[model samples]
Target: MGTQERLDPQAGVGTRVREPWVTVVWNDPVNLMSYVTRVFQEYFGLARHEAEARMREVHEKGRSVLSSGSREQMEIHVQAMHGYGLWATLERSDG
Candidate 1:
């Protein structure tokens, strides 16, 4: 067994590392599509079309990445999303 393999067999050698944080909004039964779009616009200041697209993504795909940035900013976004009564979480991009 090689030294690299001995350290951790699960991780392949020379793995690319990405540490960006992302704020994800999950779909739920309560919020309407239009309301979600409006919330995105109001909170993130996204244009109508962009907000609509994100809202649709959440509606259809069950989740949408609302924003990506530093961990502090992502945490703020997650809290704001919670304030709006939306389900949300933060995760590393490389997941």
Candidate 2:
């Protein structure tokens, strides 16, 4: 693989930069809102309110961003969500 280099003004050394990836859950007719919230709580350890909020966002907005990190982690999350029968995907975060 070819390595690209750029001078870092702050560190004065080349650093590899990678785009952040995010796990997004999409609304689906198969899953109930309470079940979605429960899954978020069980998998992510989110508080009840936080989980409910995310579920609501998915219900109203058609999608909700659940987590963000490396591409590998995001992919793992997507797979896990699929295991739970929830519609999910990962992509490079736009913001």
User: Alpha-carbon error at 14 in model 1, in Å?
Assistant: 20
- Go through the candidates in order and give the clash count of each: 0, 0
lDDT of 1 by residue, 42-77 (tens): 999999999999999999999999888778889999
**Pairs of residues clashing in candidate 1:** none
Model 2, stretches more than 4 Å misplaced? 1-12, 16-18
The C-alpha local distance difference test score for the whole of candidate 1 amounts to 0.86
Candidate with best TM-score: 2
Clashes of 1: 0
- What shift in Å separates residue 6 of candidate 2 from its native position after superposition? 8.5
Q: Pick the candidate with the highest lDDT.
A: 2
lDDT measured at residue 87 in model 2 versus the true structure, 0 to 100: 98
What is the Å distance of residue 38 in model 2 from its true position? Answer: 0.3
- TM-score of candidate 2 relative to the true fold: 0.84
